[model samples]
Target: NALTPPNFIKSIIEEDLRSGKVKEVVTRFPPEPNGYMHIGHVRAIFIDFALADEFGGRTNLRFDDTNPAKEDVEYVNSIKEDIKWLGFQWDNQYYASDYFDEMYNRAVLLINKGLAYVDDQSADEIRENRGTLTEPGKNSPYRDRSVEENLDLFTRMKNGEFKNGERVLRAKIDMASPNINLRDPVIYRISHTTHHNTGDKWCIYPMYTFAHPLEDAIEGVTHSLCSLEFEDQRPFYDWVVRECEMEAQPRQYEFGRLNVSTMVTSKRKLRKLVEENLVDGWDDPRMPTVSGMRRRGYTPEAIKSFIYETGISRSQGLIDIQTLEHFVREDLKLKAPRTMAVLRPLKVVITNYPEGESELLPAENNTENEEMGIRQIPFSREIYIEQDDFMEEPPSKYFRLFPGNEVRLKHAYFIKCHDFIKDENGEVVEIHCTYDPATKSGSDFNARKVKGTIHWVDASSAVPAEFRLYEPLLGEDEESEELAADETNDVSADEVDDFLKKVNKDSMEVVQGFVEPQLKDAQPQDKFQFFRHGYFNVDPKLSEPGKPVFGRIVSMKSSFKL
Candidate 1:
């Protein structure tokens, strides 16, 4: 697993390198500046940067900003931050709109060469004329227009003479081509909206299919790598480069995209989650955005290692979300400090021990990492253990604290339960126990051992905190579904409703808890592994001075093996 396995695209790059087909490799991550980047983008990001780096090459961070209606500066900044947080740096940053003048001139060149023509057909009319996969499409009525007239009209259209949907520029490719993408796909459409970068300098914008190929060519990108979903668009990509006659030709190769089993990667569906208030924002901890994972306590090293383990393959299948959690736990085992946190507090009074007194008990920071050293935790006569740790009438074989059973307090002393109190609702509220000072942990004395050890915090010194436990964000994982509605270039209202229905309403549960006093100065993003709980990150957004909100990254135990 040390060396990356061979895949189709990697083979192609290796072959290209061996035959001197390329000297230096140049790749680009051209993300559309429309929405926040998600985990799926991490795969493409890894592929683009890793492939180029393998060959001593460079990768460019380019924003395909052709559609101005949905793009904004916020998405652009988030994308950069996500990439940086992912630990990959781009050699250069460029926007698709940066080459608007050249794109417009290229449109004019296509017109002059009779390879393009401006059509007056409405969008619905064009769709109606564009035949299905089994049927041949008919040419536009404006297909036979003279080159001079088409050029004049295209210039006027660019000059804002025509309203949106009134006209569009189409490729002069074969209308009867078996590949429907080659059936005179519209290359440019009129949009009156101002671009985030270009402002009102241009109203006629090039389509993604048209602008993508040209952008790569202009940047001298040698290899354009992307997901297999774009395989069909490769032909149109080649067409624009060949017909437009660019100096540099970036060959496109497709690989299977990374799809986690229990999450949605569709941008539109994710946008729906944000707009419908089902999620806090694009970076909501439940959402699968890179920022979401970061905020949820996922480390860059862990994420990168997880991707490396997933490998670069052409036949990616449904990756279990547990696999990701596995890597997260593995990375934190030695790195994150081992600490005790009582999530749901159950007051325990040491009736026979010294009352109104607390003692400092030595606790190891991490058993696996001794170099992290040790810290002393304050243990009081009236300490707080997890509410679930004590069952007044536990079932068979339950060795935890019961009416008469004894359990060891982790890193402290063995405590025997004597009595319990209940509220009017018949719910157990308080417990009475007696701690044997001779049985204190790390003591040179040995006594009778207990099968159960539960974590607890000092009542007087424990810092109050909030614990946020998260589950699968969606109730229905994308089982065999191949593509999101957006991939088909359409998302229906019914589909949105159905996706919304699958959202897990119980995705998050917040409860007040107590942590060791050492966490009093724990700043945002501090990570810790709680005994019997899970790895947690200090919530950067909701954490306040002396009171932190911890987001559970993953539990300590897992059924996943590799």
Candidate 2:
């Protein structure tokens, strides 16, 4: 458990502790709880909880459930489960809706101080008037409304008098602030939708930026940690806390967000994949979601190690997906037991061996760890090897099961291909070979060696299982193409429809396979290293009591050095 040393956040905490500027470091992970958590969220969770742990402080898990229109209990529960599975716990759990009463009264206080006004513009109108980076926003005609009228309108809006988007209360900040977020941002809006937490009791909900800082102050959170995208909103965050007269003040800090090449974590894109029947579900093995990775058999330790290596910084850089796979291989190398599986089963008949004769062979459970002990595998005359292991006419240096060639059958005996069967299509149906008993594995009579060793399973004892191979979830060219589309300022439904074409049709490849008899009772989430194939996990959704579906976690190769 070698932790990342002395990064910027760590340095800040150390200095704060030394200077006595902060007696107790308190942090919180406030997620909007609208969708499933993705890999980018890993950095925030680790930093928030890890910082508190290093400083002898506390961290709370808070759900910023301000907009109930898109939030649900399923997402809320899943978020909590993902955080727990990531090896952390919350000191206290709170929701933004839990303080609706206080938030409502605080809005009244802003109105009483003549620092706020109610605007009757529609959502589009507000956005239009909010202006752009170069232009100053125009004020609403109702901006000069008296405090008494503003308070009345806000209270009535809370009583469900206003329709969903009729009117919204705005903080009376400068309309021409250079920082656009400070220009009279919306503080409260009327939403008729029932909330997962608050139910139908309240119709007026506080905006995220407005409620976020208030929630932090109420919880006495000393540090409000979030991604760099919220940097522009920091000013408004401070304004809400200060104007509402909250006693406890928390400072907000930003960090670079993690991104992976060839994978898009955008909620819009992910939801498209789910809604259009492109992916199975949120826990689809190809997805970057925590549950998806967990279902695919990615160990928490591997994810944490990868995150540590990535480290915290102010600038975000794209991480190649291979780096993540390398960590998985690194963590599972010494843990997962080695076994043989033939994904595309090709029958191999050992003509020289006695027919119907099966015997048990000993194989190391894990070559890197002796304490894991050995597992017995059944070997017989008729066995199954990978279809790709044999070639009728292999190129030069090819030593596998071609005609008139001798090769080793991993942990078994040397087999020389003598004949083969073919179907009407002229495809190799089965391979016929003769075994050399003297060259049995672990035998001291080693006079020669073959160039290649392939894995196999006994035909009689091979358990039928499904192997799911995955490519990049995003199409090879979709990353740049989609970014280009964004730059064109196209938000039409037709533009969104083009996403289906951009999805990687080859992302998931399912094939029937045969595993060793030892894997007969392999349960869901069980992991094994298939020799020459890669590490795989028993898929929970598709796996049954006797038959299991294995999801390829990562192939057993890497270009990553560390």
Candidate 3:
């Protein structure tokens, strides 16, 4: 982490520590447990944990579960798992709901100070009156209610005396302020729903803007780091902390968020994909979610390295997804074992070889990693090669397989295609080739040279597998389409339909393939580099005994340079 380049946030923290403005650097990763964490959250997680750890401070994992209508325990558990998976352990775990009683008291204190009031305006009515950027908002009719009356009404609201959204508590801020967020923003709303953590303990819920600062102050958080979108909300954030008169005042800082090309990081869009059965689930490999990337075989080291390389900045830029993929390849190059997996299998028969015999051939597990040593691969009379490797009618410079052409079978022998059998539909059903004993692999046979070499798996002992190849979920043209900038934004039905239309139909392709018998026992999450097929991870959810499913993490090659 010391190698990480110093950015503005780091400089600020250093100044704060040096000037004694802060006794310690305490940060918190407060995510609402309404959905799964995605790659976009990686930068915040890194900054929070790394900066706090570097300063010998602590970081807390806090769930901002203010909106119980969308929050659930299932999402909370998934978030915790994701943080741990990213190689971070929180100093303490807390939830906003834990301080509901204290938060209520703080709201009451605001009411007593004449800084807040209860509003009877409906949500739509409030929105309609809350003016646009060019105009000032009109004050609510109930904004002038006396402190005692507001307190009584707020208490009744908490007692579930009103239906959902019938009333809300608003701060006594300027309605004519240029900043829309300062226009007497709703601080609390009546929601008669059970919270994931608090259950049916209360019907009134504090809004996120109000509960966030309170939670930070209650936890003694020194710095509350959030994305640039919250930069405008900082005024209100400070207002809540100052007006509520919290014992501990936590300052808010904003940094640009990480955005990837062609990735939909919005939780609403992601949820729609899952809810509508457009994707396999939240952990679908094509998704940009942390759990999805994990299932896709991305290593924690790769993700961390990518975030570090991106660094901290104030400009929100779209990073090429290939840049992230480059890190995955770098991390996996030496770690994953090299093996052969024949996707789209083409049966090849070594007609001249001993019909019923097979032999073990020596193959290095990883060419670049000597410590991996060697592995024995079975070679028999019949084997499976990739279908695209061969061509009955060849093209120029094609160096894989063709009729009457000799090509070295990787880790095996020199085999020359002689004949091919065709089905009634004129499809090539099988290929017949003959192997020369004198040209065995690792031998000093220089008498004949083959212009091509291809990889294969012994059909007799191969493990049948399902291969899932993936592409970007959204098409290139759709990449620039604007989505909800914030995760909490509500997406309309038309928006969902328009987004779905842009989804690439060919995002994933499934094919039955065969891998070397050595991978027969490959467990879920086990990673490997298939010869000519890039890297793959065993599908955790779909893979079963004897028929393992492999998801292609990335291809064998990329034009992307770091």
Candidate 4:
């Protein structure tokens, strides 16, 4: 009664089951393990696994590792880890190489049936003869060889007698079909390359089009869902399935791929970026790759929520990257605890307060999570405020510190600035203020209202640390262009290289900053809100004992106003 729930191929599967033509459903996520899976693949994997689960069917994780020259065991492991991280487990892990022997025998069957031939033409020559979209392709001169001759040559190819790229086995499909995939597609090619799994046993390897359907049929997949780009290839895929004489005859369905703004997603292009050192690695936080997002603190739940909000439309669309960040903020707001740290320090001396005296101030761990409880912050005579908090000559709307102005030192005392000292470069170095002892925080005497309540770090008891401010990898205009041509992916492969170029010239400006002494014992991955500045988390890769590096996740607000 589930009726495959209405998508193209699924609807067919549902109808078949209802009509007693089939009993169960089966689907597969077949990724070519040449590189780390990107955010786009996340959607495909979820759809493949979820659809089968919904219909009481099974899903297989199949590696289309036909191109051994590019595939690696590293990618295979990463693929598995990513799937498990997303909370999906495959019924079985299958590899295209597992059917190498069967695929070879099937090729022999086609040759014996006089439906395929061995072509000695080079790759370039084959492309030249394939013709354009407007014209029909020409058949190979060797296309008319006898079945015995083709079979003998193919057998020799299997025996590794031919060098790499010397010859290829092509199906005897139509050259006049408008769909170029049907133009006698290449079924087997000489690679002479050692595979990650089957090793050098395969000098002649099966092509993706030839290997994928075999993988599905062998695994008993009833619906083979793929992207819209493969729509034209479905006919050829079906032809090969029929020629191979599959009993189940798995159907192919197409859907639009996930495309996001500000990033390029092609594996080849991403690899180029990595090779060219345009990025740090595949998992660079700037990359649109799933690994990159993970390192940047994105949760799988947030990613899934973004996908759901984007909706599943037949028409291809590009979603703004900001939409993703929005969901991340929404999720973390309720989950992450809040703390305070100063990025740029400016000294403030309380002239009226007794020297060397300190008090423990109570601060909320997270206003959103009261159960997290309160933490004690040490406050003393000499403290450090944000450098931007005080100006000798402030603008009319600037509510912070200036001569004769009163502001509340957050969670402590109200102070009135009287004087300031500056360095030779004219930068405000320090400020002198008078604190109202009667106006102690959390007391009935703290009745006086102030225009601003600024965060402060006790200078004598503060911890010295590194604060990293991250900006978008590229500017709005440049990122827009990169997103527009994702299919042509000329951007970063390793992203670190591209990041070096696209870095906001002032992306990371080092400053002498201070944090409350309580953070001195904080370890990596510990997150905090820098009071009025922004939300941040410790940099796992950069932080060290006694020298912590904090990465700014997002500011308290979007862009700063003048």
Using all chains and alpha carbons, the TM-scores for the candidates as numbered come to: 0.96, 0.94, 0.95, 0.89
Candidate 4, overall lDDT?
0.78
Question: Model 3, residue 201: displacement in angstroms?
Answer: 3.4
lDDT of 3 at 431: 97
**Superposed Cα deviation of residue 57, candidate 2 (Å):** 1.8
Q: C-alpha displacement of 221 in model 4, angstroms?
A: 2.0
**Any runs in candidate 2 off by more than 4 Å, and if so which?**
1-5, 476-496, 558-562
Question: Model 2, 1-562: lDDT tens per residue?
Answer: 3244457877777788889878899999987777788888888898898888877789999988887877777888999999999998899998888998888889899999999999999989998999888999999999999988998898899888879889999999998999988889888888898888888999888888788888999999988888777788888888888989999888888888888777666666677788877889888988888888898899989998888888888778778888888899999999898898899999999998898788888888888899999877888899999888899999887778899999998888899999999999999989999999898787875798788888999999899999999887775445432221111122346656776677787789999989998787998989999998899999989999999898899887942111
C-alpha lDDT score of every prediction, in listed order: 0.87, 0.85, 0.89, 0.78
Least accurate 10 contiguous residues by lDDT in model 1: 479-488
Off by over 4 Å in 4: 1-22, 438-440, 444-448, 477-512
- The candidate maximizing lDDT is 3
lDDT of 4 by residue, 1-562 (tens): 4312345555666687899766787889998888888878877887788678877888889988777877787888989988887777899888888988888888888888888999999989988888879999999999999998998899899899999889999999888889888888888999888888898787898888887777788778888887766777788789878888877678888777787765656676567667766566887666677877766667777787776666544546777777887877787776677766777888899998898788898987788878888888888889988888888888889989999999988778899999999899988898999999877777866456888888888888889988877665555544332232111223444553554466444444445587878787777767676777666777667778877777776676565443
Root-mean-square deviation per candidate = 2.4, 3.3, 2.5, 3.8
1 against 3, candidate with superior TM-score: 1
Candidate 1 per-residue lDDT, tens place, 398-452, comes to 8789988889888888999999999999999999999888888888656587898
Question: 439, model 4: CA deviation in Å?
Answer: 4.1
Which 10-residue window of candidate 4 scores lowest in summed lDDT? 480-489
